[model samples]
Target chain A: MAYIPSMDLVPGVLKGDTRAVARLLSRAENGNEEGRPALEEIFKRAGRAHVVGITGVPGSGKSTLVAKLTAAIRASGRKVAIIAVDPSSPYSGGSILGDRIRMGELVGDKGVYVRSMATRGALGGLARGTLEAVDIVDAAGYDMVLIETVGVGQDEVDVARASHTTVVVSAPGLGDDIQAIKAGVLEIADIHVVSKCDKPDADRTISDLKNMLVLSLGLQPHVPAPLDVGARKAARWQVPVVPTSSVNDKGIEELLKEIDRHGRSLKESGEIVERQAAIAERRLVKASEEMLRDKLEERRGELSVLLKELAARRVSPHYAARKLLTESGFGGDK
Target chain B: MSVAQTKADRIRVIVAKVGLDGHDRGVKIVARTLRDAGMDVIYTGLHRTPEEVVEAAVQEDADVIGISILSGAHMTVFPKLLKLLKARGADDIKVMGGGVIPDEDVVKLKKMGVAEILLQDTPPAAIVDSVRRIVAERGAR
Candidate 1:
């Protein structure tokens, strides 16, 4: 299959050509080789957009809140791009219900670019291509990039590591209170939102989250050194549990203000640089691992032969691996 | 070819609704069926224009563009879509349609380069099969 050259696409992407941006994102999602150089070229132009990740249980009104937030962001004269990651069908590797329907009105708006991504069988609720897509949007000069995850609890926490600020969305009466207690979800929240506040139980959910945050923060003092250090510093900015109802457009302004507050806190506290450094580190490590895996897969034939020998008990698995490594020049002259 | 091989080479289809038709229930069902059948389906939610549909198809590199129009505007929408696809150099993308389409218009749509036209009553299984067949034919081409 012939791919579009990075030379042709990178300029268009940098110029904010929507078509070019979409094609580059597709290439990234499919892992096309040409996307790498384009991404590399655009990486320097990124880091301007604020990346926010919103995640919650399946019916927690996450998309509606995203739609509201996108409008609020646009009202402030800032361009926004949304990456809604939906779960792919395990059988077909495709998705049916995307976040597009909830946020359809934003589709035709020039200031907004909405893209739906399927998890593509990735274990994490966020697709493998999500971060890359976010970067492309950022390079295209979007002021904010909101990533909405599939809300499968722990697996979705990867979004926290990907975004500058993570918003954990919950709703009253959806057993979302129980779902939020799943450890990874609550620990990652810089902002806690209790959506569907029109319901009677909304305040209860809000209080429950506040209580949980208090408990989690209380326990942070006992956490180990380096890990607790960031938490202790981040703890200065209290995690606000805001109640919102998209149905009535309630608390949206408050949520937006809280988001701005968090952004400001991160910048003032110098956590923004640290967060970006951590993100870069993670990206580098992931890329290196992928490269090593590809190199090993290229030697699959030799590995399979060794696997057969091991199956026949001719050699132990460890010995076979060591011999293969040595033969492949990876054992460093041993 | 094995089922695994066929699935690995999954067909990517964009199931779109053009004009002001809000009756996407059928299209959604078809999208689900095609997805279940192992084709990557991108559903451009309701009220899309022909230009938007073609642009999305081009960017997505979709194998098929299935337009589900219920608004009696199929005559205008389908031809406009064909023209847009040709103008954008995306004539290689197969076009299909369903929902409230009459029998006589079906022939016109086919002549205008629609790969298949399913009536409102067409079964989900048939929709899935026709898409697979059309994509296979395109592959042969």
Candidate 2:
């Protein structure tokens, strides 16, 4: 062993010790290698800042839009952190992480921090490491965190869910009415932006999105899904939509102002606390699930034996399932 | 153990993207390759502010930080990443970069703390080697 230290350095992160935050993020992103244990430490010190998620179809200029917004936010004198989530190629297990390329101009600003994350096959469309990445930035004292997801479809929704406010970006004439109508994006956007106004169809796309939002909002509630506990707390409010373009630098500032407005609204209305609570509740559940998952993986050999025994009629399938679940902590009352 | 002990044992590296480049294939590939090679690679993905990447480097206790860029944004992104890295006590981390860097800019990047600039077509082995050598030189310090 090379004598790597434990992840206890996370406490220093809150004090603005950049070294400690970096080590913790490294552990969190790299599955904690020598620093993996820092995750729990990092999580405990998290929850102090606002998180914003940005997603859009590919080439909708999501990254460019984010760049301008973050830069504007920084100029206003707040520390900003960006997490660019890109799709990992199934075949190569690689991601281009090209989103950061759009915001290159902001790369050197002391008030800004940007990180690229591969989705790493996490089912939720966001990278499993993303939550920890956000936490690291949050604990390190960033006033705002912006997460940009590599847009494909529904997975982008999963990425945006982690943010306090989520912006869905779209471009005119790219996918047109069909994309605008997709169930994935319309439902999740707290705000929608029609990017690339320099193009001719930009205004038309904005019109189409507005029309679609009207139709969808009017007909929705059939699902009656429990309101996102946070959404329920902020009841009577609808997410907003705006337009932007990186090419001409249009509407970028307004988009950020909207985010700030939404943040304040949630706070003034007492929904901010509720939203944080909801986020905490969900994160705990996820942590437990991950813990259980690890246990099952650890017991793979015994699980196989149990399965073999069940197949040979040595035990009932139901009993085997129970035993396996119990051994994996699903049986615990706690 | 003391902070010095941690620094000695762990070699931190940051892999970042600089400027209006939305193509991250090279960044991801390099981050994973570096991680598997047993160094801590902190990747700041997409449209990162240069300040953010440098902050990550200093905070992560990186020994060698690499930037991946493809957009013409290199002019803006690289200078910023370098300037902030120097200001934040991260000048110690041997800086290197890759992407569609112009031949003319390579000289400037190296002069500005980028000890190495891997061309777009640089072999993975070379990247791994450059990082390893950088770490080996600085690891025991």
Candidate 3:
């Protein structure tokens, strides 16, 4: 039997012990009975690495894009950690596990570490325990972390909550995708990608993005978009609309440059710190909610009786909940 | 918590998606089947680094860790996971996986610390059986 440490492994990680780092991360994602105390220690040491979240439709060549991005980032001499999220069985709470096959080659590279996680019935479109996973990578000494979300729905904006930069990918000939994103999806993007630029319509997609950016920024169409107009100005619209073809490897370098530039902008604009603070705050609230949810479930038998009474019209759920809260010694007050 | 569990007894497994490729239908089915078979399955949801999956294995005290990879990243994800298992002192945990893998690579995966690789289109029962053998060999209580 392997010697299992009963203590948090953060100190070992800080000392550059990869094994300890890995062990702590595993514990974190398990949400094991011991996870919280372990994470509390690692959490204080996090925030050293840059986190990037990439999301797009399934057929949008996300894996290819990630492959190319990994190569580019690796070429720049940075160690990269990628967290790929795949679909999971809602019933069994496990994954179908296909993402790894697409990213095979990059896996062999010394500087790159790739991990796949199933979206195990987590609300908000991310896998449960993802932050803990990111903490593992961050603590593992990787300079950059890439989070890839399964592009099932628009709710993937949750990535933005954890990452310092959010990349939303779309392909040409996605006919109404641009229009679809306008409603709510596009707003979360720090950068937008027109993938598969080898196609003829890719340029038009880029133009459409420029137009959309102008409109969203509340600028006139005739007014050159901020990035284009300020191409020479010291101050510029940090956001860049990029065209990339993971197939031909076109525009990938430019895309990386844009991503790096945007990272700088996020820092220059003071958004990175603000966003990280918000993410941390959201994480605390989520942790508290999960803890509370477990507590409530522990009293499920009592709650069910109250719910049944409410259902029978003997009392309102709100009133009953309020009463329960009172009995539990909570005021339900702000 | 019986010493000898029925066929319906919960077989605890950790199903994880490894790498940046995001397809996961197969892993989900296996998790569901194993659960329906009365196994306790802990799913380390997406974007998990390999370390996270192994950590989950130890924490769940799982008898097995099932890795599903379709992103072509299996070469790195699996070997690293095994290495970490050994490094973190978890060589005893049975490691298995399946998903869009070529036969040649499956052989390679199995040689590299994976006890079994459940291929795409594999019958769900085969996966369950593989888990059963692995669990039995480990004398999982």
Candidate 4:
């Protein structure tokens, strides 16, 4: 059988065909240059999925929690797609994507799709394919899209900026911690999950997180200046620390309910617009950086030509920079 | 999540075990060999059924499904996986296996659409070359 061209994959993807979704997703992950147009189309058809980002430390039970959360979401009769990200080998550029093992028998379910990603040279707990893969699943008609990060510590906040709702999972007995490595991670969460609530130290973990949230909120109370009374009230969200245990299915439903509630509040309070705007800005900047990198790779010869001209005292740096950008199609002829 | 993919069409294979293949040292070695050869290998650990294996390969969009079995269930395992792959419209993914098996059985399995099966004595380097040839052959088609 011949390969299905990337251009021909868009229709089936738009209609939620699992085969097409799987194929297009592989192309996106590989950064296939042929799939760019189809990706743009996917971007247009997205925005319906409730993309929730879940991050935590290595032993925080993030995968088990994601598996449990997928079950809860599916129980509600919704379609889901999970992008479980693991790190790639920097030396070999090959990876064993074993996230499917912890996903707990989710295979063969038409309503749920689980994909394991390798962060091929991508930093901040995400692969470069992550953002596009989310859009592909979103256009494929999944009601919920869950992104499980590479069990991050502080400064892996890319998941927070990339998601509509960020849930940070902090397990008990992780260490004697000043609230899970202090503010960089704690401040990014729209929801806090204290996993292994069945353990003896669970309460302390919960209380520690609660105290940190309160102290942090007090330190920077209402940083967005002042809006009207209704807007301010709508914008203000009290990030709840939900305790959960995948062991006995404890608090899973409450976590799902809180997720739903957060989704609704964002919509009702008009904060979804602001959140989407911020996400779009981030996407724009990321795309620009990627394109610039690609252009530089494509125009290495042009750079050397400019060097030759400069060595001969023929052209200035400013003129040469503009010439390269124009020739590389960054800006219109001006 | 297959950023597990195409940095210049690097071969992606799902190396798995189906049924009660209680031992896995060979499979683990083969997975590492393929990875060391610059291939992305999704190793689905022991106790997988044909349905589960096919589902994984389809979802992962792998170019091949390499089953390593030593429990003397190759006859039942390979045919069923091929059937499931066909039913799911993913027969495009090549299927192969390795374990202790007789030469005549290898012929029959090959006839039944198993791409290539390496007996126990086959080498690690040959295994890597076979996979590369298999994927390269598929591309040539």
Candidate 4, residue B88: how far the Cα is off, in Å? 1.4
Give the number of the best model, judged by lDDT.
4
List residue ranges in candidate 1 displaced over 4 A.
A1-3, A176-182, A225-230, A292-334, B1-11, B18-25, B45-63, B80-94, B120-141
Q: TM-score rank, highest first?
A: 4, 1, 3, 2
How many clashing pairs does model 2 include?
A: 40
Segments of candidate 4 deviating more than 4 angstroms:
A177-180, A222-235, A297-334, B1-7
List iRMS for all predictions. Answer: 5.3, 10.5, 9.5, 4.4
Error of 2 at A227 (Å): 4.7
Q: Candidates 1 and 3: which is better by TM-score?
A: 1
How far in Å is the alpha carbon of A247 misplaced in model 2? Answer: 1.6
RMSD of 2: 7.3
Off by over 4 Å in 3: A6-8, A15-19, A219-236, A323-334, B1-90, B93-126, B129-141
TM-score of 2: 0.72
Across the candidates, what are chain A's individual TM-scores?
0.88, 0.84, 0.86, 0.86
Q: Estimate the Cα RMSD of every predicted model relative to the unseen true structure.
A: 4.2, 7.3, 8.3, 4.5
Q: Which ten residues in a row have the lowest lDDT in candidate 3 chain A?
A: A225-234
Give the count of colliding residue pairs in each prediction.
0, 40, 36, 1
Which candidate do you rate higher for lDDT, 2 or 4? 4
Looking at model 1 chain B, which ten-residue stretch has the lowest summed lDDT? B1-10
Model 1 per-residue lDDT tens digits across residues A170-218: 8888666455464667677889899999999887888888888778777
Model 3 lDDT per residue over A1-334, tens place? 4435526466776664545655565565556675576676667777788888888877777767887998999999998877777765555544444555466566446567666555545555566677887887787688888888887455456777778777888888887876776645565677888899899898888888778776666543344532222221213444678888877788889978887887788678765666777688768877775555555555666777888898899998778878776665556543
Model 4 residue B126 lDDT score: 99
Give the C-alpha miss distance for residue A32 in model 2, angstroms: 3.1
